[model samples]
Target: MKRLHYFMIVFLITGISYAQELTITGMVTEDGTGTPLPYVNVTVKRTSNTTNTDFDGNYSIKVNLGDTLSFSYVGYESEEIKVKKNDSVINVTMSIAPGTLEEVVVTAYGARKAKKSLGYVVSAVSSESISMSRSERRKARRASKKSNKSLNKALSGKVAGLTISNGVGYTNSNSSVKIRGANSVSGAQQPLYIIDGIPVNKKDIAKIQHIDPTKISDVKVLKDKKATSLYGFRAIHGCIIITTHKGNYEIKNNESYEEIVENSFEKVRTSPLSTFSIDVDKASYSNVRRMINNGQQIPADAVKIEEMINYFEYDYKQPKGDHPFAIHTEYGKTPWNKETQLVKIGLKGKEIPQDEIPASNLVFLLDVSGSMDQANKLPLLKRAFKLLVNQLREKDKVSIVVYAGAAGMVLKPTSGINKNEINQALDNLDAGGSTAGGAGIELAYKIAQKNFIKNGNNRVILATDGDFNVGMSSDKDMKTLIEEKRKSGVFLTCLGFGMNNYKDSKLETLADKGNGNHAYIDTMQEAQRVLGKEFGGTLYTIAKDVKIQVEFNPAKVQAYRLIGYENRLLADEDFVDDTKDAGELGSGHTVTALYEVIPVGVRSEYINEIPDLKYTNSEINRNFGDELLTVKFRYKRPQESKSIEMIHILKTGENKVSKDFSFAASVAWFGMKIRKSKYINNDQIKDIVTLAEENRAADNQGYRAEFVRLMNSYQTL
Candidate 1:
């Protein structure tokens, strides 16, 4: 009986010990601020069990009684706490790194690797060091908030070969961050920002201002191919890895994403008279180039061949007459398939010198919502606008309007010469709350109309990620609103900044209906190109409602395919309707289009068979004999309602191809290769690279050379 009692007591003791091995759950945060720190590495000393804090800084792990748990975060002092018998939650507060020690660097895909093991150069700045720097700068500028110091500006002189520029919005959060130099011409040049092992998109990064800088532990910049290769295509732009303080509970605030709606290819025989609005926007081209260079297959919907072709500058003849644009046409054998002939259509808008340009009345409609908290959005936007401000003359005037859950005028009708006031107002702007884009648009138009300059440049430059969730957010609603607003004679220029949950479709619609142009600003260089180099072209509308209608001759062609401009296609009757909305062309803008035509005698698999028409058939028109196609263009003056018409007929001539043609063809071929289009069977990356190299002209600015390098980069991938 005594032996049985001893065994029972031992069994009870073992069961109690087993039950004590429970899990601990809690958050780690800054000691005083209570700000959650993410990416805090939690581990059990001498054990393999480990875990990381989520975005909310929440973490959970299992432990037995008396087990020691260690919490370590870069730039933060390490802490250890013993697990008690009944302890279910143990929160830790980590301070800045104490003394000179080996710093831990987070690399590709959130993998924490020792800085010493990394072969490539990685510039890392500890939060404590930044704090010291900020403290000194704060003493110098006692009037300003220490939190306002932009990440770009904060790290300016700290990193080697890293260039930081101002971003688009109000705060310093959206500042442009670049690593090393530009490797891809068409891809995003800004480095990828990873917060606490989570890859934060440009959109969310804009709102990073909400993240307490004090909660940050360290910022590491990954430069070199090996360091960034793990991120795949996104790493082509390099990467900025940041580990913040830890805490508990996941914060699920950011939920932004995007997908393009693709336009389907059409049959020429069924639709001989192809009509489409002339698209001068080059966003699609740059976007596609980004995808390709990132080692990604370009989304078919994102492949706009017309935009790609129009991206490069062509040696088209300038307009000699009173017309706003000149028409240039050429016929050559298709580079991809020799069996088909390609017809190129080019339109060169009359270039007006800056002195000749009209006085500008500009309103900057900025989105300062929570989404605009990154260093690349609002901050970069502000920098971009500053560049434009520097370009403005005394005659030009500017106003600032912002939206985020509400719309308000920040800077009222300030003259270009009063740059100090404008700069001050820009600096005073802050970001928070939800996006109220529609309300901002309405208010901006009202301001623009109040200060409307007749026959002058009156435009609202909207800078945002187009994350309109709060008010009037639907595409249909936004399109309708823009359509109604365009009647005010105020053109719109939508400058997209940041990525991840970017509403590309919404922005495109706004620009399409608002009688304006759309461009994506991925880097400060792009900002300089859009708002500085092409300032006149970007802001001044040379022609409006521009439409292109091409009538292919059945006698000369069996079947034809329009290379791109699928989204711009219009009804055949819409071409003659002056009331119908089309596309707008800016000063000095160039638009190009290509059509692959199958000769009557050639047999191609792309040609679809159709039953003979019982009532009407596409009969040969002898009057247009030997003429391949007739291209008709109609456009109106910026302020005019009626369109002026122009026409060009492509006739049988020498199949001679110029460097411009070859270069444009090469770009198109590269785009197709990236898209893996149904028609890309004969396409080869090597051939595209060769064509680009052979046709590269005197690249005074090295743009062509950059493009060649990009093509080579794609080939290697």
Candidate 2:
């Protein structure tokens, strides 16, 4: 009996030992060179647990006793090892797979191609080298406070034929990288940068000062004509492609967007009036396009139907009378549901010639925080601002204020004619430290107020990812500050950049409260559209506090639902209250709004049954014969205090619509489908695509065509 008890106790103890979980830590290195490989995928055999090596090739994963861990990396042999009873650490040494050199090569757009398939020489640097260099740089920075080594500088001796030169004139802190030497005499000579499949503008190459070297899996330099041709004419200098361990795109994103609540059908007999602020900002459309192009999941809140509809220019007539904008209305059968009717309201601000536009006092409030260190943020911003600066005239004045840990004035008020000086100040800027956005805004507003130009276009252009970590960073705080500053006659322009950690909600609030506009610059093409081609429209606000109020006639309508602008909805009394804040209309800008309506005697699943009123009469008045709706608009001149009102009347008649109306409806439908609205379904997406394609009128800029292509791409996804 004693022997049997001892055997059972031993077996129980052994079972407990086998069931115990242990954290296995290790370093993965190349066998021959003994160099640490970053982002080496380590997975537990048969289990879902996995991890990747850090910058120093260190990794840790939890596993049970007798479990096996596998280490795998591209172009290298994979290995697996079993955990022993007493094992706590496991170090792996990987060797290059046979013929790896000829079998694989990293190419542009994060695609891998056979080395022999490319005609030009493709120089490559392993992540191990980058990690080692970064570690050394960090140690050096800690030892010497003045050391400001950048990723470009770290690659000086790593790749053959790649030259690194420290920038001259504006800032010695900036470094420029060249693959095959200077190929252009006037234009940018640096090679185009491709990070995680997204192309960074070549002109912004110098702004690519810093990146988290730990996240980089590998870097490849594509030199020579054949290789450069893949990226178009802009890649004349060459191309540098950096791939991350997260595959072609970063998945650990912290992008924030405001919540959107879809509008429900309202009973016209009870709620006849629908009021909202007119929105001209098109940031949502472009931002959504960026997400789609990156092959990322589209956030429902990111699809603002109104913005998407307004993104394309409409064929509305310009204002001829005293009004600053012209209004047009159309009624048609709903494309998605035949039981419902669609109403489209369009507004076109009068266009002003560039020379005729008012002179300006501009304050550039730039975020130089650590979050903006990515190639797409600060660097892209610099290139974008350069385009705006090139359009400035002699009468314009400019000042620059940057915030990173603290706020400071980089350039005093200077004439816009001094383009070289302004450009120099912009080029000297670099990204580092925490964001102090509120402090920066206070300083920028102070500067703008001090140099306030009466009757002139005075504004602050804030460029950031909206990740404000230090000092008064909340949305309410920003809104309050902007609202107070707008009383001083200084408007705001919020230009957003970057992807991860983007604070879209805060930026939108700042723009909405400060009598300003907001736009997200996702690429050089978008930058050109916002800052170059539409310079006057972007800088000069023709009207402010624009609000729209529509009263549906119960005789012609039963129930109605506004398509978008959920955030812009205002109280009915706010329509007539000049104290209430609304949207600003830029010169030459267009705004469009859509409404889904259930005509009299028509039924829709969107409408919910409501009990009859107890005391009030809910009957339709036939006295308003054939009247569909009455639309009233209120707006203030840029320098005025009181508001001007305009009215337009629509009558029920034949449902004739323009191509613009059809296209706008199609965009709205697409937006609804993406937002997963109950009003739209996947089956109708094909119809939406066909409608967009059919109504794509003389699309001079090819934006409509691009939308069609995006629709097709989305279907495939």
User: Whose lDDT is greatest here?
Assistant: 2
Model 2 scores a C-alpha lDDT of: 0.84
Model 2 lDDT at residue 711: 87
- lDDT (10s digit) by residue, model 1, range 123-191: 889887655455655553562343334445556788777876665554434556677753554434867
Tens-digit lDDT track of model 2 for 113-139: 787787777888887777746467667
The parts of candidate 2 lying over 4 Å away from their true place are 1-251
lDDT of each: 0.78, 0.84
Q: Score every model by TM-score.
A: 0.67, 0.69
